[model samples]
Target chain A: MVGSALNQIEIRRLVKAFGNRAVLKGVDLTVAEGEFLTLVGPNGAGKTTLMNVISTLTKPTGGLVRVAGYDLADGAVAVRRQIGLVSHKTLLYDDLSAEQNLRFYARMYDVPNVEARIETVLRRVGLWGRQRDPVRTYSRGMQQRLAIARAMLHDPPILLLDEPDTGLDQHAAAMLTDLLHEVGATRRTVLMTTHNLDRGLELGDRVAILAGGRIAYQAAKSELDAEQFREVYYQYVKQRV
Target chain B: MPLIMPYLRKVFAIVAKDVVAELRTREMLSSMFVFSLLVILIFNFAFDLRAENQKTLAPGVLWVAIAFAGMLGLSRSFIMEKDRGSIEGLLLTPVDRSAIYLGKMLGNVLFISVVEIVILPIFVVLFNLSARDLPLLVGVMILGTIGFAGVGTLFSAMVIHTRAREVLLPILLFPVVIPVMLSAVKLTAAILDRLPFADVQNWFSLLVAFDAIFMALSFILFDYVMEE
Candidate 1:
């Protein structure tokens, strides 16, 4: 739904293993340049592993992954420039203030106009006032908000979020939902993994289920309502059992 | 020139982050400094460090304090990163792996050097030893620290994800850094004795060589070691 013809993420027969155990069996998927794709799977479905591979945090055991038109192996740095990741962990230094953390990453990314960009992102996340406070002093929701600011600091075109709403309260979750809606409105390519099927369906323009290390079902929001998607999701789970 | 500037900026960013964090918390520095102070204190009380046998034993005592304290600092450097999952934040950046290693290694060097600088005068005063060659004694300390931090940084990264990282770091580090330790202890003794530069030139060269070799090897291997 709401996508260009260009594919932002291209995976073909992707396989990831840890020593003797295989986490991600051969899988294929493609996300369009402006699509918000929500990926849902049961625990141990390798959603995080898949996200790690796409982010270049974990190397794939086999097959191929191309992000933003660059192969992961051939051009990981280039790919890194195009993508931002918000994992379950904040990936932030708790000892650092939000501003300092953002500044550090800005310098690492070689972002131009660093100070101004930091202010804009902080303000966008409603964290401009508390930017000077150490991250550890913030609530879980505040930290997660700061994390989103950090990820978007460089204004990357693609975002990868893995369970960002985990450990959040209802109020914080609603705040995150508003922020994610704003993020979705910007037309950036997004791939989010979640256990909350309703949230996933609500936020994503398209929803896909990953079962047994592969994409088991996929449909656009226009084609599948929450009831229909739940039926499909449980069908896949039943099949797995 | 243009290419290297950005790369250097990235390296400096990491160093600045570590410095600011350390300054704010002082966890690693305070522990390392107190641990070194304790080592010197225990040794001072335990041994009669009169000038007679002091020349023979002082070098060992000084290097031992520095080495053990440096190990503590090194283990902490990465453990902090791993504990908070910030290492993943670092690895997710576009910077080269070598930049991360160099940044961390330099931070380790800075911390250990600060401890050494403070403790050296205490060491001299407490042991009642005359360090006439103060400058050269410091040079040896810095050189030996470079080598130690180089290898120690790599090993720290390796053991960071392990359950018993604190115990494992010393085990893995002590053996590899033997050359640096020996060369430093010998050169420190020779300098304190006011030996001619020619007399201890070989040891100095060995220390220099070890520093270079350790830094180069760790730099080359960091990329592979960092892979998840």
Candidate 2:
């Protein structure tokens, strides 16, 4: 499940270290075009770091990372145009309305037909009614929905969600699950990092466990047994801990 | 024209976004304005600014107030982005990294200039100073602000992730920005004194040179500073 020739994202021997400490040590992973990959990892297991490197937010220390066939080294700007990220942080201006926030990002991404696209995304995330209200006034769930709207506003083919459900309540998380389902329905290549085993297994076509700064285990969802995989997840995570 | 238009548009987008955000919350401008006003008020009352010494004292006091208040605005410029994690949002875009720097620097200049515009007239009244050379003084201040905001914007991004960014920004910023302030103060004093432009031509050249140097340096270095 790791290697697919000519995939949308291909990471070979990916190394990411912070000075003396290494977070991701020679990670090898790939997500084919239109495939959803859920990377499950324990706390401090470099999930966000991997997402950051892929999104061109964090530069990798070593190894080849190619996104949408563009290398991270020389083609970061090109890669940025190909991916949209939804991190735990909302990444929004609280003072700006939802519409304004989208407009700002639309201009940044050079999105075509800005107003219409903003409306389309806002409607997709069910935030069109509150488009004019300040983001600071939004609940955690609403903010996450707006974040999804933001990520999709540019219509990038690849989506990277790094623990986007981190701060949401149960009801909001469920709503997020629904939103994720809708996003998955679009057949966009998505790489989501999650600690929620149930949601992780449910959403991804393939689920991979990240432990010891590497892909410890992985399998296609059709080939996985939920109970056995839960045992395997805890085993890998506990070993790292 | 084809290549530059998109770049300029992106830069304008960032500036426009900052303006909209600031207008909505009044977070950056109001604080900067009030703080600058207070600095002038404190100096005015403390020194008993009289017409005799006001000319000499005004340059240092004015620059000090503007620099300090500008620091507040500059610190908040990236801090706002970092606080909401919107800096990453900006970085994730395909726009050139230098465009982000320029936009942020321009936004800072605009905020600082607004603070200066409001405070200058009040400063003149408070110090019992003349308004004859006000335009020239404004020109000097704008040049100083471009330099100030240029270096300040770069340093603000450098310290955005630090635990003590609010404190660290001034420590890192003031030393680098001393030349800008010095030139500005010199020109301000020269203008108010109605000194021949030939006499102070050196300072004017120095101000313009530093503005160009700072902006160019910041623009070139911003990508490195922003990279993790």
Candidate 3:
């Protein structure tokens, strides 16, 4: 996991501090190409901060971070071209219809064959039937699914999701799980931060626990038992708390 | 660098999307139109706007209405994006960041200009400006609105994430846009008074120069401001 396959993300001694407080202090993590890595962390554990850095939304204070083989410092525009981000919020205009939102993004991303791509993503997210409806009228689950479609429209090699399941109900959460399953099969490198331990661990090929502004533990999903993982999770969290 | 056509096309796409959104709800436009009308009505009654007062006071009053109404629209430009969290999505797009500013400024200009167009004829009757000045008035309005909207759009976006943005926008905007308003008011007054172009050419130059400066500054600063 450290350096074998084509690495999509390589972060070494990454530091992000706001004023006097450092949210991420010297973090190092690597995600292989096409790997599904779920990072479970508590609030203020720097999980979102790392995702922001990778997405080029936040500039790192120190250390090196490479996404899709582009350095985070100088290659932001290039990195942006190679990644798509889905945050907790839907980020779609409420008044715009689903079709309009997708098409708007499609044009902004300069996607060719815009009509075809919008249709493809809309259908994939099961929103094509209601594509003409305003996004304001959509349910939370539907919006999240449409967000998935939106993030995938440009077909970037890497995807970054931050607390996407925060506001979803059980049914919607299950739908998201299924959607992620289908998405993971495409061999896109995904780095998702989640609080839902059960579901998070279930979907990831590898799981990492982040606490105390750093990744405390990481292992392949098959290598750790569920009960043992719970013990290890709390053990790391207890020390940090 | 990316192709210029694609860059320009993205700017238009943002404008179209905003126009469609505004048309659906009429949120910003309706408020702006009504507000502009209210300002005019208040001035009509407040000042004893007789024939003598109409020349100086009316031009000032008309500009006051347009500037405040434009502010009403500009204040919401980025507020909508902030509320819906769409600003982040816009920034995440691969297009040039300046294109976003241009697109948003275009929408604001369109919105403010619409309000101006609706109120101008009414302004003529209320203030007794002859219809002969209509052509010149239209030109002045375009130049004035561009400068106003350019500065307003930038300041509004700058304060979008501030806690007191609703209160902050006018306070931050009015001072910076005072130069624009001054030139516009002087230009409109010159036209109404039947002054020679020589008297107003300086004002027109100032208006265009302010607009060009503001547009360029906003274009360069938008990317930095948008960074979280």
Cα RMSD (angstroms) for every candidate in the order listed: 2.2, 2.1, 2.0
Q: What lDDT is reached at residue A37 by model 2?
A: 96
DockQ of each: 0.87, 0.89, 0.73
> Among all windows of ten consecutive residues in candidate 2 chain B, which has the lowest summed lDDT?
B1-10
Quote the lDDT for A104 in model 1: 95
Q: Which digits, one per residue and each the tens of the lDDT, describe model 2 over residues B143-217?
A: 999999999999999998789999999999999888888889988888888889998899889889989988899
DockQ for the candidate 2 complex? 0.89
Worst lDDT window (10 residues) for model 1 chain B? B1-10
By DockQ, the better pick of 2 and 3 is 2
lDDT of 3 at B149: 88
C-alpha local distance difference test of each model:
0.91, 0.91, 0.89
Best by lDDT: 2
Candidate 2 per-residue lDDT over residues A17-113, each given as its tens digit: 9998999999999999989999999899999999999999989999999999888898888899999999999889999999999999999888999
Off by over 4 Å in 3: A1-5
RMSD of 3: 2.0
True contacts kept of 1: 0.89
CAPRI-style quality class for the chain A–B interface of candidate 2:
high
Q: Estimate, for each residue in A191-234, the C-alpha lDDT of model 1 and write its tens digit.
A: 99999999999999999999998889899999988998999999
